[model samples]
Target: MKQICVFILVLALTSCEYFNAKKTTPEAILNEELQTFNWNDVDVYPTFSECDSIETKNGKTTCFTEVLTTHILEKLQKDSIVVTQDVTDTINLKFQVSETGILSLLNIDTDSLIMKEIPNIEALIYSSLDSLPKVFPAIKRGQQVKTEFELPVIIQAN
Candidate 1:
């Protein structure tokens, strides 16, 4: 009886969390996962309806960029911008797509010469986005998330 009692006590003590076991709760596990999650990366990049047909990841990004560039180029082409001294520059546009699929421009970086040549360039770019194809928010861990992008657009005029 003494030996059985000692054995049982040892088993119980070792099994208790104070000795060895640390029970993992759902909340704890979730918190741990959140801490390790990469917020900057997404499983699926944000895209437009026009790019929905693309099956590959790279294809989707390319299509998204092409569609956006085409829209902006079309808008700029209509303005008949005239520049002297063969102006050539690149506009680095930074923007965000909200989790709700709404787009907002954060900033536009361009040469001062380009700004002077195309006085309404910023407004034109903003306005062009107004009519872009429907946007879908990026997907991360099966949840829609906001994403930011920096796209470069070249400006050239003779």
Candidate 2:
């Protein structure tokens, strides 16, 4: 009877371990967690200095846009770049805001006509962006993350 009881106890212990064992490897679990994370959405959007007073999401977004637009327009006016011929086009500016609130230009998309008319247009845009105050980068899962923005700049010359 003593031997039978010992054997039963051993079996019970082994079974418990088997039941509690992990079915998936650690790497697999990590991959699953990463896959579940949504890349498109962030917990908090990037903010500019003028947008600090805004409380609502929509209000902040509008303020940010307005501040950036005003900065760019002011810079362009200061440069006084002349277009030989009347032209109207939209320039697409792509930039990334780093976790430390630094803005880096990624790319600028403009038609050939605009490029020819304003050879230093790219430099002007970069200077305008750099002149703005630092921005708080977007936050994801309670951590700051790099975020990208694509802004359309319309240029109309008469």
**lDDT (tens digit, per residue) of candidate 2 on 1-158:** 99999999999988897678567889998999999989987777788877888888778767766777788878887888888999789998887889998888899999999999998998998888877888888889989999898878888765
TM-score of model 2 vs. true structure? 0.77
Best candidate, lDDT: 1
The number of the candidate with the highest TM-score is 1
Mark the regions of model 1 whose C-alpha exceeds 4 Å error after superposition.
1-21, 25-27
What's the distance in Å from true for residue 24, model 1? 2.7
| Model 1 agreement with the true structure over 84-129: per-residue lDDT tens digits | 6687889999989999999889999989998888888999899888
RMSD of each: 2.9, 4.0
Model 1 TM-score on a 0 to 1 scale: 0.83
Hey, what RMSD does candidate 1 come out at? Answer: 2.9
